[model samples]
Target: MNAENPQSPPVASVPLYQLKAEFFKTLGHPVRIRVLELLSTRDHAVAEMLPEVGVEPANLSQQLAVLRRAKLVHARREGSTVVYTLASAEVADLLRVARSIIGSLITDQAGLLADLRAADRG
Candidate 1:
């Protein structure tokens, strides 16, 4: 039931998979991923991240805003600086898993490349 219009039909709910995809889409940016990786270790003030992220201040701010909107990170103001922290410990776990997956893929590719080179010589 719509609060504004009692007779109006309820809005369609987003599918769980669709929501998941949207969440991943939010993490697709390199800057956002770096930000998350940084927060994974410990909370950091915006100034602390600027040098590590190596992006213009405005660009980093935009990435932080995206992470904030996705609920992957939380921000708080401390005097003159805004500090950020991961919303859940699971986010750090997720990054570790992703790193492992990518590492495995790279290792597999390297093995295949070595096999191909050996075959060429043989």
Candidate 2:
């Protein structure tokens, strides 16, 4: 426990179950995913995102609060409004990877459907 003991390994802290739960809970909403996607493009105020995402002001605020708490997004006051942006470029990269996987899955499913249709017609 002594900081001066260079030979000692750092204490292993208990896993943060509550923090993990909150992070997943925050990401559980579709609106939050859309918000993250928009932020990945560029920083924007809640007002700007509202019109783009078609969510009401109150709903947007709620979603942003969840993202902010998870540290997935960061906010700063810009005059009258708070501009929100992804906490890091890695967050955008993660979204891109997720989208790629989803696209591949959808394409595979479509191909299967097409094959089934062709067989049925034959």
Candidate 3:
């Protein structure tokens, strides 16, 4: 683990948690999340996804580039249009799981708020 022995593989390789953190960081943008959600249903051209994502062409292009770099989506040229699709089905499943977990959190928070209100009324 020193500079001179840099080529040597450590007793343990890089931690999986660090890789997971990097993966989540790639998905940390609202625009990217929306783009992924749209692609989850079906492939879409840049033109087709523009209005749905409600961003300027420049912004959309930027987000697409990020997803492309992360290998989360694949882009192809169909005629003059640039179409994008999820790189794998697993991306869709991950989005779905995130939605489910967030939904549960929202429900739990609502219950907590209702309990607080009832206690205040007593």
Model 3 segments more than 4 A misplaced? 1-13
- Writing each residue's lDDT as its tens digit, candidate 1 over 12-32 gives 889999999998999999999
**TM-score for each candidate, following the candidate numbering:** 0.91, 0.79, 0.88
- Stretch of 10 with least lDDT, candidate 2: 1-10
Model 2 segments more than 4 A misplaced: 1-24
N/CA/C clash count, model 1: 0
User: Per-residue lDDT for 50 in model 2?
Assistant: 88
lDDT by residue for model 3 (1-122), tens: 64558887655567999989999999999999999999999999999899999999999999999999999999999998899999999999999999999999999999999999999999
Off by over 4 Å in 1: 2-11
What would the per-residue lDDT of candidate 2 be over residues 31-64, giving only the tens digit for each residue? 9989889988999988889888887888888888
Global CA lDDT computed for model 2: 0.87
